[model samples]
Target chain A: MPDTLSEATRSEFDRDTSVRLREPGVHDADLSPGWAIGHALNGGYLLAVLGRALGKTLPHPDPFTVTAHYLSATAAGPAVVRSETARAGRTLSTGTASLFQTGADGEEAERIRVLATYGDLGALGDDVRTSAKPPIMPPREQCFSAQDYPAGPDATPEISKRLDLRLDPATCGWAVGAPSGRGEMRGWLGLADGRDADPLSLLMAVDALPPTAFELGLSGWVPTVELTVHVRARPAPGPLRVCVTTANLAGGFLEEDVQIWDSADRLVTQSRQLARAKLD
Target chain B: MPDTLSEATRSEFDRDTSVRLREPGVHDADLSPGWAIGHALNGGYLLAVLGRALGKTLPHPDPFTVTAHYLSATAAGPAVVRSETARAGRTLSTGTASLFQTGADGEEAERIRVLATYGDLGALGDDVRTSAKPPIMPPREQCFSAQDYPAGPDATPEISKRLDLRLDPATCGWAVGAPSGRGEMRGWLGLADGRDADPLSLLMAVDALPPTAFELGLSGWVPTVELTVHVRARPAPGPLRVCVTTANLAGGFLEEDVQIWDSADRLVTQSRQLARAKLD
Candidate 1:
């Protein structure tokens, strides 16, 4: 959509272009290209918009944690974000942000409701330290490009041009008739423009992978009902390793847990979401 | 506190006593005896109160998902709950609730911000069903009561009388000088009064376990910054099994994931929280 890949990535994240401050604690955000799952805009993309607004209104510079409830599906357009500071403490601040759109009757209807906590991750200090090993992944040269997957007739071109993903063959069995028999997906994710990953990009990357339930032989549109993202740390400058796992899929509902590790092999973000499973 | 363990358990969950309706969409709740970690009340206990209020206001009878941001520590006293319906869909509803308390200046101040999703768990249907097996635990007779651990001079008696916990010896290394190389705490949890486990109790049980970081030799008040609970199903009447594990602890912070299983061997709830690591 933009002249260069870097420009496109920057445009996607540029608050001035994507989110325009209309007034104090209120803003208008543009739902641009490439951040969509089918026709509806991606949930994480919306979260990033709301998070940016919350970050500006709150005292904190980074979004430590954000939980968004998808009220209704929204298409590409201009949306309004209204944020309120629920609590402002010395170390942490909590608030609520509601993303709305104009209805046919000229009334504002909410499409996404967000609750978030913001703080300076670096300022928290490091007295205790321990970390689990990152998920083992094959070298980028050996992995298959997710971009190579045959696009459906209705597939949007912006998706492939926006996100660069290399899938781990072992967990890509869903592509063929042979399912993995396990609910998991592994891939390497980076902005197509080769931009460095940040807290906001980490939020978008958590939902970039295909639904892990697809590996369990469940198909169709799996719309998320609620999603929660925990920003563990800022990412180093490089592609991020991604892993998505599902522990349970029952009663037409499933939960997906996503883990993102920066190039430095440090865990940067973790998220879990509950979505309605569309089964054949 | 209530004369007997049964009475105490009932009192903790008695909506009429703990939650008093002040007006439409407004409620006053009490943070009472035995639910405190020290001077501040337990995060899960506060969640149960807010969840109960949200469950009453939303059309959905069950709280399928809830995420709360702890802005500041709350003490034992009366707090007000204000709830707003963000979206009222046909099958699911999203809402926000803020718990507030009177400050020294006699002004209402927010303590906790909650984002929740409510729906009819039963009505969701059972077309596609799968579940991860519950964690392996010894019989109740073989496990040791958490109460057996000698309390410090500051230990609150209400914690012991409110919850009956039988620790899994394998993960209970923190009780002694030996620390589990891995950050984890496993045990069986139930109401001391022997009430049947439900969604509300399940919410409380998720946070009832001691911080898993303790097993990693990190001690002190590991307060949660944010907590999210996903109610998978209705418990089948009995003691619930619990497992708390931490995958990463860095930058003076860690994330704990909690899993709960009902007596009938069903995974009733799963939760994840980000908390500050209080190391010695």
Candidate 2:
């Protein structure tokens, strides 16, 4: 038998260079929506970090999918994140996090829950089919940055570092530019600056497609009302394909379905979102 | 000045045929599988009654689209169903229901929630583009009935249902011939029961199309995993057209997307479902 080390003798920090640890925070500017008030961290921002944290927990480190449902919001104030492992099945793992924001009077203000699942690379098979194919879009190299757009000029430092994207004429590929051995695309993803890949980071990569799919003349911002993603398996170390299709848009809402396939033409995950599309 | 009726003089329940009520223990069946434990009411039955309830609550009763989700089973015990108006906005109206069955412990065993919304019709335009074309199945008039394939030796109620279908050789019009209009079918459908021309009832008529889409072998039990329907607008009180595409089946599940179009090629509603396909 190999020699065993005592608890105090072993270092708590990870020694391997390939492994990473993440830190999440709530900034001051995250508030001001005024719907639930006094809190600085918005649901959208927390949602972004949740996706990043989930992606970081995957075995082979491939970003597959993330989805969140707004159950009920805590009142409005300062908050902390609480995560619990729900189930650790053989092939699938699920993690749940509840955002507990604290109020000025030292009471719980608002609460939000997130459920995310991770899996290994072996879950997909050879058969892959989709009714709607990804339409051609601007080249990844030529696509404009979110800062170039008039909506959120301040999105650069946060959004730009979050995803390293590669766009063909049709699909956008974003992740840390790594080779996912499964023949699928892979890259560095989630909040850049080495933050945990959480729900918001997943949405940032997922939402990047719709805006770029149009010709240069369409001017509008389609904010999502709800986004639901189902991942069949987790990613390995490479490029993941994200394909999006618009189901139907009527009145003030439009539904879009995005399918994220691995390099080997295997289905990894899929997402469906309904957005409120309006002229900016 | 307008006169208002006193509470003592005003009526609560409708004496006329303004609403249709379905009492508990109406359509109980023990043959339901594990996923659907309680009695499996006809999909059309629920659609018809729910539509009528909406018509009575709205201002003009001009709703055209109604969608249902999570088409699963309730508990195996006491059964109860109640529907009430949640909120009514200018362009949209919302309603909800609590459906469940009682348990052996004298309490509500399982409960399901149904949320529906209604919207006014959109302006008709000629650009009618739909995913559905005419089906390849047989036409309606020349289909065969139960007499064509007598259950012969295997004469269970389930066998009789399989034998009693009227199928068109071309479009494969498979239907369980019930005079109540609550049966499965393939091929083209015309309103033979002559029910009121309302959005809800029309949607019910469209939802039952899956089981009949194929011969489905000898099993009388076709289980729906989940169903979602969206109607753009209500059609005139006339015949409608529907085309279905059984896209794919995997992991013990099959999915079909149906497009309901009015005679002149206007999209009426889109319906789809994931179901457990059985050959027993």
Candidate 3:
């Protein structure tokens, strides 16, 4: 088992092994609030997991863009799910994943839909343009430790797990440090070793922003309702800074639009997420 | 110029001989408050113009769907613009239009982006499914006219120009029978001619919802900042209704969500808009 798993990058996480392409089921411990006891799982977390799964399916040395929006919230158990590549064309390939979960009362609680497109840059003509440059920031070695931002006692085990994170004063990055029994979480993220550049490496860095920003205020309280993200472009790995400019809060919804720029001052990628807010 | 004008089928509008595929270059009369001026002329009216132009380019009997979203507010004048087809397949074609407005001071005030898709139903392989199924309503001959509703002076001009609308008792359908020359106004709308069918036809009946629902009860009125709309399915034309569900107001900004449904109990499209709120 250990020999076969080495192909997947090793996560900083110690307790929970990084999910493998062969793994078909998610642990029950990952289910968080807004999730019925009988609920299937978190949609946002599922999206991330599926992203990881689909990312593995793409050919190596490929660049792809994955975008997802919630059609309806779904819960866990009994309902079936299947992921398939509809058209894996020579230049561009498309993949879809569908998740279905049934409730305790026999009603369907959720449905998750994902569409991913993988592309080979070499095959296309050059038409490259970026709106803004990526920002430069502090290195991971210079940042503070995870203990300083401890997850509260009541914090879902899914979130309390440690993460190796570093911020470019302007951008946020992190890598999974420990197994989070909880379904999903966000916080400072970065690599312990400093190596970067791959999509997974960037995602490991980008996904940490939400938890980190919210934690700055809560210190321990509050949880997210849902998280929706889009990657507009990819940034280079280096001593870069990212700035999270605006966080719009209205009604019971919160939306954050963040942009990451590489050290070259070229705009890298833009990301936005919507989450239900809770005052702790 | 006199010979180019022709009576439209409804006898209420004049069809110009010169199709306007671009934004208006000349100044229009100053518009009143509460009126969706850009929408009336650009999004809705201008589309008719584009259809006329495209009609000249393509063969007759070309079925297409036009979707427009206001990127910024505009004033009367020549706006640099361009149109291009992003994708042109045998069965499906997508076109995008961009408009840029330069003010008297040579400052650009607004940029408008529109995307439209043209399709031939006969091409798709035996798969045509429409989700909306609104209930039937009484004929136009039996329904009461806007003469029965309260009218505001500035609302007369727009109110007078009405469309055929019908709504089931559960939903709200709005239209202005005779719009006055200025400010915001409202009146119930449904089957002006009292035609009944599934919700698909009803989809074509209603344009965007008015901004009145969000401004009601506020000390100051609100002006639109920007508006976006999407038509998921073409619903039948009758008994349609709209109910203003909720509005988020803060920091002088307002966002409203409206739900439209047909007589048959199917929830149709949901409309949303954003605007700046101010005191009347």
Candidate 4:
């Protein structure tokens, strides 16, 4: 595992998301299996990849908003990230990226497509006005660690192990014999590799939990068909707070809205994702 | 006005969104001043324009989800929508489109870029599960029509005149001398043209209202920096109920989350948009 990289090497995230310029608006990156659910890559991790590529392609330094559409299931391997800058201004730069993996027949398949706007989080200003309350979660010590219920390699998603995720006992009843039908999940999320959470890392933190529908007596790897992320503020170098709530599941389509509050007690990101599900 | 087009002419929406294929993956459509805020086109109308183009380029018929990033302020005139298919499956197809308008430099400048997933709405089975409550509002007749507070061209947007939108009296206080300071806007939206509301038109309906922050006692047209639309169901042929709420206004950036319910009392669209609001 890349977790034990020497101090001379980059952090697990910086290393995994690092990309090389192949040409203008194109880069080469490897889809690290460690950041995936089985052979399927994590949607947030994919966004992080595109974010990194976009961060490089555009003049802005931080990814302010990202909307990704998972066109097809991805395999863990080498992939090409193609980026394009649509608009570059002083405060905000908008761009798009597509991740492509070549198949055995020599055909390049696009796995994920993204549209993002980048800006300096430092310039986002301190004018915060919010009417919504943050999720109420116990200290990280009180909540049970997701590692408590470790499924085998075939079951437990690798992405979960790469992050220190603790779930609210009230919402994790589904993990045990009893299931809660609330369709909500709250937790404290931190990189298991000890990588400090940033706007880019927050991308991985948003989708780093089991589907909220699991509490509704549904069990399976819920794949995200599409995800939209709004990065409001920069994280304050520590484990962040996370809450995932699913309000609707119609026609086997479920929408999960997530909120991430950094350790400083600031809401850094708000995301809503649409995923397909099978009612049992 | 084209509102009274003869029976042979297409409806205002159908005519405005109709696109002509210029070549493979390219389309030509004129931006109508009627579907705009002053000179800037409405964000949702821009999405519908791209939706119409995507609807033609992709194999599927209906757009299930659309995410648009407004790169620059778009001017009403002749523009081209360029689309590319990323994937086409049996159930869903994904594609991207860019609306480009030629500037005085004779350069084709990209204005709005979109990523959308299309599917057959007819195949979306009737399995709806939602814990969220639809907005409660009085009957349309009981509510005050937006036309009641109409302003001159420089004051009221042209879009308001083209749509028979009715506002909840409780929230429209900002339009008058009194400001509500609740950061919420509830209204019933329908085309003045009486073009029956469908899935495509619902795109325009999602963003047809003034910024919810107007109730916060702010003025000026709020420009949407980014928008994401989730189409879960088809319309039931009537004025759609719309409720927009702004939770946080941080650094002059306000997040407006919207819910649109059709006449059948089903949630047809859920959208979240990030717009820049300069506080007075």
Q: What DockQ results do all the predictions give, each relative to the true complex?
A: 0.64, 0.09, 0.02, 0.83
Q: In candidate 4, what are the lDDT values of residues A1-280, reduced to their tens digit?
A: 2322354666777777778788889988877888877678888887888888888899999888899999888887799999998899889999989999999999998889999999998986798778878798788898977557745335667787788888888888887757788879999888888888998988777888888989977887788889999999988988888999988888888899999988787888999999998788
lDDT of 1 by residue, B1-280 (tens): 2312354346445532256677888877777856877677878888998888777778888889999998777778888889888888898888888889898999887888889999888786655455578788788878868556756434534565677788888887877778887888898888776677788777788899888887888668899899999998888887889999998887777899998888877777889999887656
Task: Point out the worst 10-residue segment of candidate 3 chain B by lDDT.
Answer: B26-35
Which model scores highest in TM-score?
4
Candidate 3, residues A78-129: lDDT per residue as tens digits? 3343455544545455454444455668764334444455554334332332
Tell me the lDDT of model 2 at B186.
Answer: 49
Clashes of 1: 1
Ranking by TM-score: 4, 1, 2, 3
Top lDDT prediction, candidate number: 4
- Over the true interface, candidate 1 deviates by an RMSD, in Å, of 2.2
lDDT of 4 at B226: 91
lDDT of 2 by residue, B1-280 (tens): 1122243432211111123344331222122222121255444434444444554555435443343332244432334455555446565555544344656686653233334555565532323323334444454456544344344423323222311233444333233332222122443444333332346545554554445425433244656533445555566665555555553333334455566655554556666554445533
Question: Candidate 2, DockQ to 2 decimals?
Answer: 0.09
Candidate 2: residue B229 lDDT (0-100): 52
Listed in order, each prediction's TM-score against the native is 0.93, 0.55, 0.39, 0.95
